[model samples]
Target: MEKWAFITGASGGIGSAISLMLAQKGYHLYLHYRKGHEEIEKIKVRCEQYGIHVVLIQADLTDLDELQNIGRTISRMPDVLVNNAGLTHYGLFTETRIEDVEQLYQINIRAPFLLAQMFTPSMVRRQFGRIINISSIWGMTGASCEVLYSMTKGALLSFTKALAKELAPSQVTVNAVVPGAIEGKLLQRQFSSEELGLITDEIPMGRLGKPEEVASLVWYLIQEDAAYITGQVISPNGGWYT
Candidate 1:
């Protein structure tokens, strides 16, 4: 039987890259996207070309009830769960509204936590599972004007570490992937042409990291060979942070 991977926010950026990589590896995919049905359809078609079963689901992860429903809908408990759905809010902390902060917490931290809580029991029963959370360098070294976003990701990093310990005895590994300034829509939106160029020059690699690069590490970490590794915040940040 083919192993299954359930990835939230699988429509674009890093999530899409991870899906394609896993498809190439013959993993059936349960792709969860909040919106962008058209883009997800494109992803579905591409995965089908690889002869992988792809199930696309649309649900806002901010809602706990929806997340539970998502857990119930999958045919089998996932062999791998990639909690990649997250949002970024930039601005001075004082200007950020209470509602925005709550939104960030709900989507980035609460949603992943609830989803893991709901699905991990079945994984424990199976005695084999991989939980991969797509965190960020901001979570590790805080970013100015990105305080709320950093807080949520920091919480996820903590969650990954704590959950890894709890699930270690069950042969389940939980880890976080911290990517720094990847070349994505998110990064593009955050930097102007000159600013982005300067940022790239600052990295030891002299360029922004690619989404595929991040996905490749995720692919490796979920493999049987990585069973002994857990509670690790693996950073693929192009030497952005030591």
Candidate 2:
């Protein structure tokens, strides 16, 4: 039987990398993106070269209606679910608005929770599944200005642990991948050149991580050999965080 992997935020750097890797591995993809139509299209075209089915799913995870619609859009339940869509708030906690908090919770917490509810029952029945959450280093160690983002990601870490135990009896696995300072448009947009330089200097490895590096860890966690590795929080931060 063909495998299906559903990845949210499939247009972002890490998301696209995961999608491509899975496609090359022969899994049909359900690629979800809130926007970034052009970028997602490029990923779709590239993945199709692997001769696997690629379905584009667009949904604003903040909206319950749209989020629910994603379940209907996909043809089958995914054997692997990558909760990678995230929104970050980069301001002092005091300066954070209610709207920012809501969006953060919606995207980073609620959507993944609901997606789990929608998909995991099928996984449990099938007796195999991989749930990989793309979390952050800030989620592990709090960040000064990104209080809300950190909280939401920390929630995912907890979710991964709890759900792993819940699904382990059925041979399903849940894990969180915490990444640090990856080189991407999101990081570049949020930090200045000098700030990024300082950030890179703080890492013992002396460089920001590549998207493929993170994707490699994710690729491992979803494999049959990794079935024993559930409820673990693994970080590929280049020695930036323990």
Candidate 3:
């Protein structure tokens, strides 16, 4: 059977890597991006080199209407759904406004939860699916300045565990990938060179992780060989906060 995969936030570094990896694996892709058209286009060009069809879906995940409209935008139900789109707020908990909380909740938790609802029925009918939530190590260990981000990611972890059990009977696997200090645009945008340096020093591996490494783990989790690995939170953090 021809496989299809849907990845949210496919314009970003890690998402782009996962998109290319799935494309290389011969899956037709629906790459969702709220912005970063140029970046996403570049990824599409590269992914097409693998001889698979690629579709771009643009929607602001924070908007309920847009999120729901995603169902109508796809050609088919995805065999693999990677909930990788999220927003982060870095500040003291008291400094976080209601607007910040709402955005974080919508993108990080609500969007994924709704996407699961939109796609899981088809997966259940087919008795096969892979749902990978791209959570952060902060979700597990709780970062000081990113409290809201941590809460949302932590919710994803719990969602993964609960949904895995619910979907297990149908052989639809749900899992979370928790990465730490990945060398990506998000890190670059959020931290200074010196801060990143300090973070790297904390990691046992002494370097920020590569996007390809995380993508590789995601690819493995979606494979038939990994069917038994549901309800698991796998962290590829180079021993940071482990």
Q: Which TM-score value belongs to model 1? A: 0.98
lDDT per residue (tens digit) for residues 1-242 in model 2: 99999999999999999999999999999999987999999999999999999999989999999998888877799999999999988898999999999999999999999999899999999999999999999999999988999999999999999999999999999999999999999998998999999999999999999999988999999999898999999999999998
Task: Give the alpha-carbon lDDT of every model.
Answer: 0.91, 0.95, 0.95
Q: Give candidate 2 misplaced runs (Cα > 4 Å).
A: none
Rank candidates, TM-score, best first: 3, 2, 1
Point out the worst 10-residue segment of candidate 1 by lDDT.
Answer: 67-76
Clashing pairs in 2: none
Candidate 3 C-alpha error for residue 143, in Å: 1.1
Tens digit per residue, CA lDDT, model 1, 1-242 = 67999999998799999999999999999999998899899989998889989999899887778877987787787889999999999999999999999899998998889888878898899899999999989999999999999999999999999999999999999999999989888777878989999998889999999999999999999998999999999899788799
Clash count for each candidate, listed in order shown = 0, 0, 0
lDDT of 1 at 183: 87
- Each prediction's Cα RMSD? 0.9, 0.7, 0.6
Candidate 3: pairs in clash: none
